[model samples]
Target: MEHRITLNAIAHIRSSFPEKFGIPRQGGLADTRGNIVFEPEYRDVQAFRGLEEYSHIWLVWEFSETLGRQWSPTVRPPRLGGNIRKGVFATRSPFRPNPIGLSCVRLEKVELDTPEGPVLHVLGADLLDGTPILDIKPYLPHVDSHPEAAGGFADRVKEYGLEVDFPRELGAEVTEEERRIICQLLAQDPRPSYQQDPARVYGMRYADLEVKFTVNHETVHVVKIIRSMPD
Candidate 1:
């Protein structure tokens, strides 16, 4: 016999990452901010009465874009240069059997006076705009914290912080908050590990700007910044 499970979306995330290309690989990788807007039916303040006590929360969400995509036993992770294949269960590939994702994000504040209902402001979230949230649970440090846990292959990978250079003129146009977040994202080296052509420029859709950059080893130079037109 087999059992099936069904879940309802309690809230949705509102973020600057409208697309998936430039999203950080993991939550808390960048100081990017997002808002969790509860669904009308689940907007009661009583549901989140004691939620503000926790510093962090876990968001169980769906990979809506990859919902219908086929799943494979193995996947190529960007961290591995997109060339080496690892067991899908060992990697955080969006192409999963269930198309589900879990993220731990900083819970900044909980507002109960929103017009639609209660809203949760979060920081360091890597979710895309309008991502459906299935459940919200408070993170317990005493029970969840495991300092001695091994990271498996992720621990063996050499990490490098890319030096990001934004042109003075274009850099001036970006706000301090945007600049900080963008730089942090670039520091993580947002490129396929296998593609390392210094001459080749990469375009990433970030927020309302088209960020053009080129990476040559340890450095990422921002060549141009084009404002995306409104839809």
Candidate 2:
């Protein structure tokens, strides 16, 4: 059996999430979108002949941020209050032996002949900007889903959502779709589980805007929406 292997990025996803802090913990949690641009070497159109027929796809990507970090056997899961230690293999921790990740996202459209090569417009992807994608596969709902399966310790907080109090004037700064996506993202409560300071504001970058908010009780109040020059 082979003990080691090498893999190259076939495509890279362009997303609004510039960092890992605010992205949803799982795919399909928000309606944010991203475009998958294939590398020149893997840009052949024939490779994706039947890909558009699927409504959703799976992304085999790398935990690019955790590269070079040592893999630990146990990890403090943020979902578990960040104090309880559990085996890393049992959790979806990025700092693992393979440094790989899997995400299931909706395939909005497949642009076959874009200038950037074949581009895939996807939605509800929990991925970072410019994330390297190793592989892609159609999500077969009949074979892949196990709705009745137990979630073990993770089911305890599966219903977590925050009340978002976004001001109307602030919502006018972006398009209707952008406003809706932002609200959905904020409702997921992107703050770390260990943080509980209601007065301390947190800022997250989404697309070209900086969203600033504070959590008061279970409600998240949007304090400001600042637009920054694109880098």
Supply candidate 1's per-residue lDDT for 120: 97
lDDT of 1 by residue, 1-231 (tens): 878998889999999998887788889889999999989999988999999999999999999999778999999888887878999999999989898999999999999998979999999899989999999999999998899999989998878688999888988877888888888988888887888899999988778988889998799999988886778
TM-score of each: 0.96, 0.97
Give the Å shift of residue 99 in candidate 1: 1.0
Q: Please report how far candidate 2 places residue 69 from its true position, in Å.
A: 0.4
lDDT of each: 0.90, 0.92
Q: Considering every candidate listed, which one attains the maximal lDDT?
A: 2
Which residue window of length 10 is worst by lDDT in model 1? Answer: 170-179
| Per-model tally of clashing residue pairs | 2, 0
Q: For candidate 1, what is the TM-score?
A: 0.96
The number of clashing residue pairs in model 2 is 0
- Model 2: lDDT equals 0.92
